[model samples]
Target: MKKLVFVFAFFLCLAISAQDNYYTMYSFVVEPQNEATVYKLVEDYYSKNKPEGIYVRLFENHFKAEDMKATHSIVFLGTQEAVGNMYAGGGNVNFDLFITKLNQYIKDGAGSAMGKHIALNGDTSTRYPFQVYLLLDVADPDKYDAEHQKFHSKHNPPGMLVNMGNVIAGQGTGHYNRWAILGYKDMKSALGGPNQLLSGPALAARQKAWDAYRASNGGVEVVGSGMRVLLGAW
Candidate 1:
């Protein structure tokens, strides 16, 4: 009886500790009219107070879906304590401070950052319903620029890449710990849409591509992970 009770207590403790890693996602819709100004602000923020959560990623668009200039910018924050400390520290402490510092540092930069907090929505009761992917591709420098430019011409996202080069792009927000492999079906659903444009047989083909992608050293893959969607129509 004591052993069973001890095991239960241990699991309960783990569950509680796990909650500490909760991440808050902030998404923005940048105005194209202020694209230049917004881009400047992004660079300024990245320079002054380097926050690891800020990730610039590419989300390809498919038929029936809208594509724009920039894909999306993501910020991966650690546990609540990580965020709390950021705000509590004051100067250069929180995001607001980062903005203020940027504004002042710039010679004649007039632009502001706007964002909305995304809370946990949908069925939380289900264990890991959504799939999270953290992909890192080799810095082809040239290819990166081309693909990003193509992604831009195709999709008009609200964010911009103030500075681009041979660098590491970190992309993941919310529920960082979970799945490590991208399920081929889900990727197709997101990219191709439910109609299965890849074709019935192509479904297996996509998995093959994913497997090949994983095998290649060009990209790092994290699958089965779950995250709360902050923006877009879901």
Candidate 2:
């Protein structure tokens, strides 16, 4: 059977320039049994010490009823340099030195321990199971926009492309090693098929559309790689 070509869809900012903005998304997979404890700890951290480099947006995607524990928590960033700072304990702030910072936040009555929570960090090159996409260009951001509008547009997932002046970000690596988390709002949904397998003339059209969009816009540039944190809503 011929496979469908499904283009992954998401949006991001420009490269790692002094003025460049980067968005980071984080997925923390916590132990299911420690749901309340985990949420409390995470909430406490955000309240006292706001994450630097990127703005934090948190959510727990529950598939079955709300009874299920949070699968992961997500955060977005506005700059790559800012993120580097956060990972390194920005300013004189030293996360490594204050190892108990995270521990102290968790509600004490909760029996669960903080160490159980899974984290992907600088020392740990291991990446959490996630999908990533680089924002390229938009052909006609004004065109067919209303057709794509939805309820709760604020949380509306990132659009295919927007105005030319808008920024564009992509992974630094040539190969897309990140697993793509397909969603209802993605290009795969719009095209009504898989875009990954597209080839020959079809691929050419895809490239052309992106080129035209970039040209019409202010052109595209790098932001960050797939390994960096990135966030998207659907």
Against the unseen true structure, what C-alpha lDDT does each candidate score? 0.32, 0.35
What range of 10 consecutive residues in model 2 has the weakest lDDT sum? 110-119
User: Best by lDDT, which number?
Assistant: 2
Model 2 C-alpha lDDT per residue in residues 40-75, reported as the tens digit of each score = 655665556666445565544433223223255454
lDDT of 2 at 1: 15
Least accurate 10 contiguous residues by lDDT in model 1: 1-10
TM-score of candidate 1 versus the correct structure, residues matched by position: 0.30
Which candidate tops TM-score?
A: 2
Q: Give candidate 2 misplaced runs (Cα > 4 Å).
A: 1-16, 24-26, 63-70, 90-234
Off by over 4 Å in 1: 1-15, 18-20, 27-29, 51-76, 93-190, 193-234
